[model samples]
Every structure is written in C-alpha cells, then in structure tokens.
Target: MSDRTFTLDDLRRILLESAGAEEGVDLYADISDTGFEELGYESLALLEAGGRIEREFGVSLDDVNLSDITTPRALVEAVNELLSVDTAAA
Candidate 1:
C-alpha cells in the first residue's frame, strides 16, 4: 500500500480535478456537500474520478456503491475507511 495519507483538502482537489477534467465542467468551488449529478458529473466522470483516486491513494474502491459517493465529503469518508483498512492489514 501507499504510505501517503490524504487530507480533506487533498481529496477535495483530487475530486475536483478529476471530475472537472473528465466531465468538462467547472467544478471550481468547494463541493463537499454538492451531489455529483448536480455538479454535472455523470457515471463516466465519476468512474474516471474514482479510478484516479484509487490509483493516487493506493486503495480499491471497487466494492463501494457509486450512488453512495455523491459528494466530495462522502468520497473522503470512503477513502479514509479504505485507508484505515489498509493500515490495519499492514
């Protein structure tokens, strides 16, 4: 696993960059509470974001339901949980 530990800001930046770039949308604000669809993030955008996040964070989010991670905060929480599990395994 990666030794990197992500902060909320890091997660926010990653999500915004991934979704905005993938979806061609200007999600240039703090969207911690905003839903993905509301921010113009479709499945392709979200999946791309998830892939980037998984690769960057060194965690598998394959089992997580896409619908459950509608916002940046939710993604942060899920990533933290996965990181915690990795830590425990290590």
Candidate 2:
C-alpha cells in the first residue's frame, strides 16, 4: 500500500470486513457514528482498526487518544494527523 488517503467508506470497509458484517450493514453510519457506550465500539473496534490503518499506511496513531473516536471521519482525521506528523519527521 502507498499510504494513500482514507475515507469513511474505507474505514467502513475495514470495519465490515473485521466485524464480519454483510453488504447491507451500515457500519460507518450505524456503528461508527453511534456513541461509544451505545455502540460498544470505542473499546477496541476503532483502536484496532486505527492500528491496522497505521500499519497499512506505514504510520502510527496516538492510540491513547481513542477515547473520543465516535465516527469513521474522526478516525480518518486521527490517522491523517498522525501520518502528517510522521511525514514531518521523515
């Protein structure tokens, strides 16, 4: 992978693939956008998914900051932010 930009659809695809959801499952909307306690995803889904994104993109996330990750867009932004730091350092 070339560390290309990620979208909500991309994160949703990863979530669907990891969570074993079918094509009809609206993970990004129904899951990621849901409140952390309400969806039970903040515990690991977003964090692990974030780690995967970082690994796939050759970057690293500030994993400790996942407490506020309530949406795929947030995840994307976090990954992008981390990647930006990585770019700056490189």
Candidate 3:
C-alpha cells in the first residue's frame, strides 16, 4: 500500500475517468450535489472508481456501504474516514 494521501481533485478525476466521462469533466463542480444516477453512472462505474480509489489511497473500501455514498462529498468523507483508520493503525 502506498503512503500517499488523496485530494478531492484526485477523487474527482478517478471517478470521472472510471465512469468513462469525457475528458475534463469536473466531478467536483455542481455535479457533486447530484447522485451517480443523475450523472448517468451505473454500479459498475462506481465499483471501478472505488477500486481506483483503493489503489491510489492505499486503503480498502470493500466493506464500505456504497449505497450511502451518493455524492462526491460523501465519497470523500468515507475515504477520509478509512484513511484515518489506516493512519491510526500505522
């Protein structure tokens, strides 16, 4: 696992790329207020994004409840919470 920390921009890029959005799509804009469904994303896209997040942040989110993560803020919060735990464990 890496020791790198992720920022909102990283998460946004990962998600947008995973979701197959066009280049330069800003997931952190007003779009963050919308759900994935509203953004035309499906479960598989989120799963891929989650995988990228794990690889990038060096944290496991396999046990996280994705159903509650409807927006970028929620995703960031979840990742931060997991990162805090990882930091504590280290």
- Angstrom error at residue 24, model 2: 7.4
Summarize candidate 1's per-residue lDDT along 1-90 as a digit string, tens digits.
545666667865766777544355555566678777777778888788788888888889889997777887787788888988898889
Give the better candidate number (1 or 3) by TM-score: 3
The order of the candidates by TM-score, greatest first, is 3, 1, 2
Per-residue lDDT of 42 in model 2 = 46
- Give the winner by TM-score: 3
Q: Is candidate 1 or candidate 2 better by lDDT?
A: 1
| Superior candidate under lDDT, 1 versus 3 | 3
TM-score of each: 0.76, 0.65, 0.80
Specify the highest-lDDT model's number. Answer: 3
Backbone clash pairs for candidate 1 read none
Residue 37's lDDT within candidate 1 is 78
Ranking by lDDT: 3, 1, 2
TM-score of model number 1: 0.76
User: lDDT of each structure?
Assistant: 0.75, 0.63, 0.76
TM-score of 3: 0.80
